[model samples]
Target: MFPASKQAIGMDLPAGMTLLLTLGVSGLILYLSIRTSWIWRHLPPGPTPLPLLGNIMEIGRSDVANSLKKFSDKYGEVFTIYLGSRPVVVVTGYKQVKEVYLDKADDFLGRGDLPAWNNFYKSQGVIFTDVLEWWRELRGFSISSLRDLGFGKSGTEDGIQEEAHCLVEELKKTKESFIDPQLCLRKAVCNINLSTMFGNRHEYEDKDLVVVLSCIQNTFAAANSSWVQEKANPNSVFTRSHLLSSALQIFFAGVETTSTTLYYSLLILLKYPDICAKFQKEIDHVIGPNRCSTIKDKSSMPYTEALIHEIHRFIDLLPLGVPRKTVREVTLKGYKIPQGINILPLLSSVLKDPTCFKYPAEFNPENFLNEKGEFQKNGAYMPFAAGKRNCLGEPMARMMLFLFLTTIFQNFDLKSSVPFEELDITPLVSGFGNLPRNYKCAFITR
Candidate 1:
């Protein structure tokens, strides 16, 4: 008998091709099996992943948070989940998340793999880039530049107040007719960011501003006119690509979260008229009807403060948050995580951690309110996330949420045609953002 190799080569063309294909497929299967086993061997325990698919089917498409919560329940808080072949360690609950962000911050400073952004950003800009030094410099530069442009200051409050006035005027145009507030809210928020970036505000109907709102190319073009004028040093970290990326990151990040939070706050308030009444009562007593709301008034308005905080915690926007990665080999909760491993510190887990909030599953402002009705800060309140990579725009976002919402409530009563029982406060899309369901409401002048 011929040797096995000789016999395979000696076969008819069809037989030989068939043999070769079978052998190749068998080899691939063997390789993948070994590689998969090896990968899981070193990482923390998790649901068994199939080759190539890697726990993706397990995760499903919608309801990623609920799926991860199930894994956290079965495998414990610090467990791994694979997105395709990539193994991302899912750190849930306050204990594990705090440790990853606060305790082992230096080790996990690198941003995690976000395939959607990584394909485009490619390790550039402050948001998606993995370079720690680059992030540090860019973050510092951005904060300083924004400070110069009046971010998180009295000047910013004035700008927001002006924008809020414009928003009220626009809503007044609706003449108490039911209008979807999403576009108007987004535009208002976008203008505030534009003012910070360009040093001037635009008319709501300005052709350039409208184009910028509708087209991303014009958005970058607008950004280009402002940032490219900055003086550069020979070894400056602010390269053209970095500047553009930073500009894009700032514009999107600045608008989306704050605007979405405001949108959700409105829906939640509309859902509960009693809560909305109390919130407006607090605003009326503190800020009054004649004057615009300011940041200083935030301190004296505990119920208002508590309501804002509750909105953040209840909606749980950015449930998973931006992923993080390990800069070096580190052990978390006794499990060894290798360098460059992606981590998802579940912000939803912390925001709704049972031990931290009294009504973790409900939308009660009492979660942030103490016995005296004073607004109390909860350590688990991490809508802005925690650690070294916490949101740079937290202060600005807080101010916007306070000023814009207060201004709206102070000026008009939010009325929706949808009955209170019928209003759906559950997130319409829960994957990346916990957004509210779309509905029309009239902003009646109060």
Candidate 2:
């Protein structure tokens, strides 16, 4: 190495100039970031923030839900908030949330696909783009594609039947007497996606596909973390384009959310064995023992339908709800909110609100049943979300859930290693999605 004294003295002027320039540039970036969109000018009341880090320092990992709950108590549902330089408007109450999602959906129908999302996926796809015109075009493509793959009526029932056969066979081969319903459900639900979109039934043994699917889970699981925001920014975690982020969004939203909901249906049934027995009796009398389950059978099975509705209502996967962004400046309740503010829909607050569902905490199918024991659709009971931006897969999802779940009950009993209450459905936060922490269950041969 060169002599320290000689090198230091020789490079003195250049080094000093470099140091001065770095300090000046840092000062400018800090000033610009603060001036841009700090909570002080735009965000509504909640918490004070520290410089550079914002209110991030005040938050602990496990304390998020509790923190949001506290804010809900104080701010009265829809309130302005912040995450870093971004301004956020948190809408907690269902009435307020329904307004944004249903009543004024045109202005608030889309979410800002953070730079990370656009870079990774290019975001040309339906889910990432906030534009209504674009979403319709893409949704039309997706629905039509699914219909062609047999998604509606009994058209997609053929795919489900073939996949269900594979699912039962896989369970038989494992024959462990105990298995994680998580993996089995993934195989079943994912196969449905594959037989339709990826053009073949995804195998249980395709480790690469499993890895990709696991990555999708891992990414969505990061919902509570800042990485979701970070990755949403351009060229950060996964890619410099929205392509990866968009693909990721579609996969997880498509897979895990629905998969967990299906798993809950089984869990709820097993815990209330009497209810399960009653449902089985209904199915036996109607759909019968010899024939496979189908969407055609759904109309005849009221109890089964009610149970599915109850599951969606009680087991809400998105606790923070799907965050949306305003297309432009708007005012609600005398609050002058500007465009691009992050919006949290408080779907959990809505679904769990006692006013909406009697004895909301407890699992009761009657909430979805009428005085006559007929299946009733609760407009307030929206798990796949609501409004113009409601889940595009709603129609197909309905068909698949009825068929697949019935197929399982017809063939086997879904048992957990422990009692259903013993299994925790309390969500673990991922980037922007909430997932069941543990979904271990067994397939009891009928």
Candidate 3:
């Protein structure tokens, strides 16, 4: 056996190793703390973030829009928030957002790499791609092609009218029974894009169409598996992957937003019958029941026009807007945001800015109306975002909303199956998009 002192030394060796390990970890944490502070010092002011996780714990999982708004209240109109190790600078309020998105458009034109979008499409399409030349070419082609095909022009109105008729026919089958109109509205909206893109519209029960819809739906739901296979030639600027990705982009943005907006509009009408009455009265006087509603009738129906604008504002879809990045190191609103920093232009803040509207929170059409009771426009209205990267599908979406809502309400008297008070207009999901909760309603013929 060894002496007592020698044995004690052997035991103390393991304890010494443990102490060194602890100190190493402590030193690392201290270093990271210093490094993070140094980096943040050059950027805009924001809440203190923890190492590695950044502000994820503070942002939480639900209602990120509101969470960012809370941070904005404390941090001012222009502030920074970290996503993991990445820093995102959020610009709130109308003036600041306008300054960044409008005045300094080119500086903030880069599309920040979003993990979800990168995994799905790998930045191949117009929406998520950072290739400036590709975006220009694609956007130019899309606008021209869509215009040629009568997207925002008068030529496409017939197609919209046809789809509107189909929707009315589908609702008629519900025959006083309570039916969730979400799927039908989705099919109608998807078919419009399908017809526009492929010159073919799928039936509501078509299997192939269902699979395509499922893929588009999964994209928003954050399903990561490869949805569309690449099919373009290697030599072309618009590769097979680019084509597939662009088509998917168009389908996802085209279908979801227009359908969700229509659904919300109907839900709002169901909740407030008085508003519906005024809307129907306007529709009756302007379009009449003899023929389908046209875009030309929009000007004559001030109430209807106001209601549509109000819906766009109140719904506040894409609340955070798409994350954009600074192409180069730029100073915005006295803050030095470094190059490649993600920018979240808080669109919801602009839509709901109290200074811009009389009652921002309440769903009031008067918000879009002047003192003369005529439909008016607000500069703060930016549901499709603003700038060079504003939504490519805005014109199509506007036409679709006007035609579909007017057509449906013109044909049928909408009534909720449940009590109006019990109906939940709150979105079921509130992350990238504001998706309204599913509700049923009846469509009785006028």
C-alpha local distance difference test of each model: 0.87, 0.68, 0.84
Model 2 ranges off by over 4 Å: 1-43, 58-60, 63-66, 113-119, 130-137, 202-252, 419-421, 428-431
Winner by lDDT between candidate 3 and candidate 2: 3
Best by TM-score: 1
- Please write out the lDDT profile of model 3 over residues 359-409, one tens digit for every residue: 999888999888888999899999999888999899899999999999898
The TM-score measured for candidate 3 stands at 0.91
TM-score leaderboard ranking: 1, 3, 2
Per-residue C-alpha lDDT of model 1 across residues 174-284, encoded as one tens digit per residue = 999998898889889988988877767778777766666667545676558656543566566687778788878888888888988888888899999999999999998
Q: Rank order by lDDT, top first?
A: 1, 3, 2
Supply candidate 1's per-residue lDDT for 189. Answer: 91
What TM-score against the true fold does each predicted structure earn?
A: 0.93, 0.79, 0.91
Highest lDDT against the true fold, candidate: 1
lDDT for predicted candidate 2 compared with the true structure: 0.68
TM-score computed on alpha carbons, candidate 1: 0.93
Cα error of candidate 1 at position 288, Å: 1.7
Give a tens-digit lDDT track for model 2, residues 104-143.
8887866664666567545556677665565665566555
Off by over 4 Å in 3: 1-13, 216-236
